[model samples]
Target: MAGKRTNSNLAGELLIELRRDDAVPLHRQIEASIRAGVRSGRLPLGSSLPPTRAIAADLGVSRGVIVEAYQQLVAEGYLTSRPGGYTQVAIGPEPAAEPVRTEPKRVPRIDFGYGRADVSSFPRAAWLRSIRRVLTEAPNDRFGYLNGRGVPELHDAIADYLNRVRGTSADPGDVVICNGYAQGVSLLVQVLVRSGAKRLAVEDPSADDDVRPVAVAAGLEVVGIPVDRDGVRVDALDRTDADALVLTPSHQWPTGGVLSAESRAAVLKWAGDRGALVIEDDYDAEYRYDRAPIGAMQGLAPDRVVYAGTASKTLAPGLRLAWLVVPRRLVGDVVQAKVAADRGSPVIDQLTFADFLSRGEFDRHLRRMRPVYRRRRDVLLEALRDRTPGLEPAGIAAGLHLVAWLPDDLSETAVVETAARRGLGVYGVGPYRMSGGGPGGLIFGYSTLSERTITDGIAMLAEVIDEVRAG
Candidate 1:
């Protein structure tokens, strides 16, 4: 209802006319009011006219007068009748001054808009050194028709890396490289839906709006299962009907909470019982600051879990490389979908990345970045704590971004708008949101920030908060 008094949410508030003194004919008054509203551009062409009852109630006019006015307008080509809906303003009478299309561009002041790893913070020195060594040793044909899943070197490397770092037991051959987490999720969703699956369970307050949207578009129903501090609650999962469940077990988005052991066990048990699949998104495994890195949940229940990970958070998002470890049964369908989609991922980047992974360059770069990012995270924490007394950011456990909660009266979008006015770039934890009682906050990514920028940005944010409070 925010567009204009002209129209809002297609639920119009009409201006009608009636008479107490009888100075004017009632139908004539109504006609004049309608014409005035239309000519003033307050009532645009094709806007639904108010129901006769509504016009009568608002103006204290008889329905007959309003109906007569509408009928007159229709005959005059100002209004058009519909089967069961309100009378529409005729299309022909629109003024040239009123533009039909106007959509403003969005540029975030402090675009914390997406929860992604900042690649500019990447350890260039280590990566280049690894790339140099890899180039020297790599064979020429390594560039051609490599594994449809991934380059063999990187696939082997990822398997070894996951086993060592994430404790996943997935074989190298089982992993298929994708464009990103969303790509893998989309493909998997397609395969499942094609197999006659209908509803899929997902975290009620999870990130990744794209996943559910793809499912719904594919004629699959997405049921939101409640999530809590311990991650997706098993007891709360609706058992009515769902063929699969998507979860972020390592660190939940928006509100960062690792899945508890009991919940993990319960979910796995549920999936096992129903012959369902669990998609485990290990988005930010290496960014752990407070606890030991949680290994892949796929290791515990290999057949039931489809493990997905991405370079987006680890190395850089723009690289757009992700991989999924699926069950043996679904692997053929997923591979077919992969080939059918893009005829395989970009070969050069895959080979170069494979070279990067094997030479221990990925690890070395991670080592260099860890302390630097940790320091930046500390700066963010110190600034927020100092400037805003009671502000609390959730999910500091891992990842490039953290969510900072505002007071109940303040909204996340309002804070975002105010920040943009101040020329800062930031965003919510996810474009993803919930209907009720979801935490209200902004996603503050400190990785792309310099020491100077983090300090100045937080100070400016604090100032905006003060102004908003006073205003």
Candidate 2:
């Protein structure tokens, strides 16, 4: 049965449709229809509903059915009524409009997008073992809300690991566990802003998409310092009025250049002289192919550098686990900001990671994957040489990605567009630059791609480049 009622106060008429053959009670159907109408704004707030008897007569249903529906709705606060007053819609939330639809992003056939790890190599068995151990052995309090500094077990493990492996002079007390690198940077940005820092200098041709916006959103003027083959230009940075500088000194992003000893010392001296802070993003320092990974710059000036590290590159980005070794002076403020941003990282994950680290499972996993990544990197370099002879791949000494310099005459945009049309996803270095004039290049990430796939992708990219050059 269908019934319609017009209320003067409502913008439109309320319509109810009843399915007579369905097993659901007729009263429930009527109640649901009225609730939907109210929520969708067909029956506006304070709009009088039809009398029970009138609606019952209109729908050809028993008067008791209408009365029961009205009574239930009234009890649920969807309607209001008094003995002498008209039954009307009670105060409720504003109507929910239909959601806006957007086109889904297309996934390229062979994506060389950076910042992804080999997820297939994620040690599932070891992770499960750690989780099981945590669940079985952890104290009852381990499940409770932890302080923003994270669990002590994890802190101790990280401190020990960093000191022994990365040569960081980390203390458990100075570690602030965060969700990932992005959040760690965000939290640090907050502390920097709160400490009266007005400008933040980042490595130009760095991860601008990730770090710059975070600084900008926090009202800090972001300055771009040029990065060459030996990481960030310390001379250029010395000229900037930036209060803090964030650099990937271990293995620079995209460029893959390890900051030289002279540059590191110079930058630290500059920081010391200006009373500024340096943020060390130790990104992709684990899978160094040519030599032992450089020790974190934070160790040189623990009080001056805020070192950030993450498991995203080594294990999987899905874990969303990373940590910051903040200086003692900024520890309290960073912890407070972390609490305000997110009460804390998940306790279970932290406990599990702590267990994993203590047991040397993390070390074993890295040992196993390091050679695999090295092989892939070699394959990528070989493919570039064999297929794209004109392009010179730099920054291959470390990191998951490297910059393949395009010829001076080639337009980065044209090559990128042509590669996209061919279902080959290669990123150009043009977007990462804030201010610089240099030859255009493509950023090729090999971590997620297999050797065969990397070879094929490079061949495909070569054809695309040829097409672009011909045009």
TM-score for each predicted model, relative to the true structure: 0.73, 0.83
> Taking the tens digit of each residue's C-alpha lDDT, what string does model 2 give over 1-471?
124334443322557788999999999999999998888776767778877877888788999999999999999999999997678888655757789999987789999988889999999999999999999999999788888899999999999999999999999999999999999999998989988999999988888776788889989999889999888998898899889999989888778788988899999999999899999999778887887668998999999999999999998999999999999999999999999998999999999999999999999999998888889989999999999898988988887888999988789999999989889999999888888687799999888888999999999988998898899
Model 1 poorest ten-residue lDDT run: 1-10
RMSD of 2: 8.3
What Cα-based lDDT does every candidate model obtain?
Answer: 0.78, 0.89
The 10 consecutive residues of candidate 2 with the worst lDDT sum are 1-10
**How do the residues 234-338 of candidate 1 rate in per-residue lDDT, one tens digit apiece?**
887746368999888888875677898877888888888888889998888788887888878999988889999888878888889898988878888998888
Distance from true location, Cα of 85 in model 2, Å: 21
Residue 117's C-alpha lDDT in candidate 2?
90
Candidate 1 achieves a global lDDT of: 0.78
